[model samples]
Target chain A: MPQIAISADSYAAQFAAVKRTAPLAGPLASLRDDAFHCFDRLGFPTTRLEEWRFTNIAPIVEVPFQAPAASGGLDREVLDALPLPRSGAPEFVFVNGSFSPDLSDPSGLPPGVRVRSLAASAAGGAGGLDVLTAHLGRLARFQNHAFTALNTAFLRDGAVIEVDGGVVSERPIHLLFASSSAPAPVLSQPRVLIVAGAGSEVRIVESHAGAGDVPYLSNAVTEVSAADHAVVDHYTVVRQADAAYHVGNLAVRLGRASNFSSHTITAGGAIVRNEAGVVLGGEGGECTLNGLYLGNGRQLVDNQTTIDHAMPHCDSHELYKGILDGRSRAVFNGKIIVRLDAQKTDAKQSNKALLLSEDAQITTKPQLEIFADDVKCTHGATIGQLDPDALFYLRSRALSKAQARQLLIHAFAADLLGHIKVEAIRRGLDALLLERLPMSGE
Target chain B: MLEIRDLQAGAGERRILNGIDLVVNPGEVHAVMGPNGSGKSTLAGALAGRDGIEVTGGSATFKGQDLLDLDPEVRAREGLFLAFQYPVEIPGVNNAYLLKAALNEVRKHRGEPELDAMDFMTLARKRMSLLDMDDALLNRPVNDGFSGGEKKRNEIFQLAVLEPSLAILDETDSGLDIDALKTVAAGVNAMRSPERSLIVVTHYQRLLHYIVPDFVHVLYRGRIVKSGGKELALELEEKGYGWLDAEPAAATA
Candidate 1:
């Protein structure tokens, strides 16, 4: 077994134990073995790597986190504490990266939509085996990404969603995953696969939440494939524990004339890295990526997004915002790639960060690689503190200095939060953020 | 009532209000006229406790309390309002929300309970109607994408709602047309009472025609160069304030 050069201890034992605890069969077993070997060769990333220069994961790698015992049932503590969508629109719940049938409700799903556990679907049960094999590891760069390789090695059970051709689902599907790392620290790997047929419209809201303030690691991978003329709106909200590490990868592939928009909101974690890569593979396809991240205390929030325009007549738009207070730090790295054949492409990217304290820091990098001659690409990044004139305006209206600061901060967030369409989810997120914001010591 | 004793203030390195003295009693209107950069706005800003104005030596007493010692918000809650020359645009903060918060803070300071949304809306609608302002402006962000006339009218609407004891109009007529100026002046005139005072700072005599002042003071080079009754505004308007520049020794207080 090859050992990761960065870590003194080997993760081969954990892979073997995970296989013994929850084993796959046939092609699934082969896939897991391949992923395990890939992870063993690459290992945990360090700060020396260019992509990980600003993010260091030594604190997370040094910990000994074992895979939890096979999912017994839905964890009551997690179920009670989690603020699952009251929108009751076909919700699926997961505990420790494993799907829980008792908590998931797929009863009211429309006839054209299909929802299944990825593990069961991969095992040649409940049909659609060909689609599973064709797109399971299609987008995830497991060969280079250690965390994704680790997640794929332990890919036991996660949510799989499929939409038939020409079908439009008005109500969104909610996928909620809750990780519990109490008693002992454990690593949870959750994987999601979404496939949409031609001319179909679907929306998905995926939430990742940790239960307690215990030290744990959640490595997640989600792949989305939209067929020709398909429209997809996806949202990912991560509210992890302050003592936890959350690393998530989102890979989206768009077909001819498809429209895909994704909004990612990250609230808290010891260290959180969300990397999203979107490819416009077909002509006339459009992509939009919007993200908002909040950092307080000693937390570190990092967002790395890549948009690839490979075909002519494609457009992409991205806007990301970050709010940092206390001794926290944030990083925003946006890259846009236009292939040589992708002429007449238009892409706009903007990133803005608000620093609420002297110690809060942000590193923003925008990179555009354009090979096409006739393309319009623009990117802008701005970092600033609260507008003193706006604060004085509020204060001159009889508000206290603290009250003025709080109002201005809320106003700054309201512009981005207003983009959320779901009222219930928006309000729930507002409640979650209100308890944390106007962060103490500011 | 407001009293200023040799108020000296500066912006950055340049002194603006150099040893100025003024007294304003209740129910009286004082018009401060000046050419450009003659300390008209600086005097208003210093009285409102705005930043960037270092008060070198001055004592401003508002109703027996030292106004210069208070914070801007404290001065606001104490019923001192400055109608800004250039109203700031605060996107994402609704006008009604700002008004309600400001009104409640002022009311709370005066030992009065805050008005609920419904009650506050009724009061705001009444005040806005008096200014001929649109109700939709209250729902939009404060001064964001608002026209010049609309922004000025909104300021007067806020003045009517807050009902401060002393209202310092700092060039409120700078950007308004004749019709909007009439509406704003009418709104201010409606709030004129025996227990309230007004300090109208203007550059043109046209605004003073609509909202006539009881006293008019011509400011030149930071100090009050000339003080007189209402006729002085007409005299300065006819003379075009160039005489004050031509005659350096004609300074008066």
Candidate 2:
């Protein structure tokens, strides 16, 4: 057995014991232990790991982060600053790992559309935590990632949305994850479980915004299960915070003929890592992942995606584009695995980036592994700058140099943004893209 | 309105135009016919101030100002236009937005009030009709996935919007079919006026049939070998460029 690199701090010791406690006993206890052991052996990754080479998570792991204390009264002024969607009437807000009912509006949700806080669901008697416990440590066990384990050990309040069969909601459900001000650096773990029943459809917009200028870490995990013929449209945006570290894992399980699409837009955070995994467990499922990240300053944003085709006749397409400037760094790691049983699986992935300055850097790797002979899979990555010829052409049309550059950059990022199913979210991301680039208005 | 004196230009290490002198008075159309690599496009690009194409010696003057000294956009604002042989495809930039921005820039330079969106759209639609262009072309990203004929018509549409005094059409008829060729020629002829001088660069003389030039010059080996009236193009066509190679520089001098 590998020796565990256990820290001596009280919080670390309690977390280590919690890993052994089998907090909620069920068929998932063994799975939880294996994940916790793997995390203990690996700890939080440093730059030595190939996947973590560009992004350094030592700043988040080396220092001990206390579990968030009870939320101090959140500032009304700060809430006003959040770039919330205007038309979405019923919204859910989670602050510092606790779901705030006052800040949330859940009146318009359709019947059978269950929206409950993870804490509330765990205490509620319907074996609700069993579902979470079953999937809780599953992703960490498979990937052997440390952050996911940490989130599991320090699990806290988050939203659990369960959509019943064949029901389509007219209004989009919005999830707002906010970090509240703490006396010291706080660690926040927010878990979301979304189970879309058979033939159901739902659109979810999730955003993360950090309050106060103090340092904090948000470790979040979300498991989405799409039943047969179900459809899920998920969009996530991570806005900038001068002093915040955000790590998230999104695991999606697709049943037969299910459809899942997600758009991830990352603009800020000192160090941010977003993992999106799609498991095509049943045949004929379709998955599409589209993302855009704009990083500036010394910020680092890393996107990791995995598409596992376990059954036949599944299709997955991924397009992630980024614009890096101001000495910032970005990494895009996309992997697709087609098992021997998954014949006729069609998968394609593309990662494109634009570097506005010489100092801005991007590392992209698109990997594909296929054991099935009859499957079609392709992946490609490109990192370049604005097209000079296009820029010249636009400038000749009387646009100033800045306008020309903005138009080209906007166009370059638009290909991925166009796929966003939610118009309001797409427009918000477009505005963020314009803000990140050195457009004329700036 | 445009003058080139002993103009020497080259791309990379190879010189394409050497010791060429020409003049285009306002309202005159000059057709420059040449074989491949005769520096016609290089001359147009040099006049428009493109990068990497070095102007080692001599100078070009447009509307009494040094054309070579200005940047491409400033030269454009000063009424210099170069219709690219292969128009660039700029995806995501709407054709109408691009045209309106350019027109307003030129207007601003001329101390004219900017056109509102409605007025601009009205003017653009009018020009589109003149060029026989469809409304869809205005909504699409600039030149993206456009057919060859559509690209040519877009260039003409831009010319109508920019209204440059000096229009250098560099091989604008290269990829056009007979129908597209006629439409392009008609579009160019409609834009021709006493205030605009055109320099049409082409290899074949088919385009000149519709938009007849007042004078024609035969360029060979980085220099203009012959100059004559409109019949000069037909003469060159009747007897290929091989006939011109027979004459020595001393004979022409």
RMSD of each: 2.5, 3.6
Give me the candidate number with maximum lDDT. 1
Write candidate 2's Cα lDDT for B175-201 as tens digits. 899999999999899999999999999
Quick one: RMSD of model 2?
3.6
| Docking quality tier of model 1 | medium
The deviation in Å at residue A109 for candidate 1 is: 2.4
Badly placed stretches (over 4 Å) of model 2 are: A1-41, A83-87, A125-143, A181-183, A435-442, B250-253
Q: Model 2 clash pairs? A: none
Worst 10 residues of 2 chain B by lDDT: B244-253
Model 2's TM-score against the true structure: 0.91
Interface RMSD of candidate 1, in Å, is: 0.8
**Every candidate's lDDT:** 0.87, 0.82
For model 1, what is the alpha-carbon lDDT of residue A124? 74
Best by DockQ: 1
Q: Candidate 2 residues A1-442, lDDT tens each?
A: 1112433243466565554542544434455455556566666776788878878776666555777654424665676586654345568888877788877788789987878887676665676776566555554443467877767655546888888899997678988888865677777777788889999999898888777777788888888988999999998878746688889899999999999999898877888889999999999999999999887777888999999999999999999999888888899999999999999999999999989889888988887888999988988889899988887777667777887877787889877877877787778766765544522101
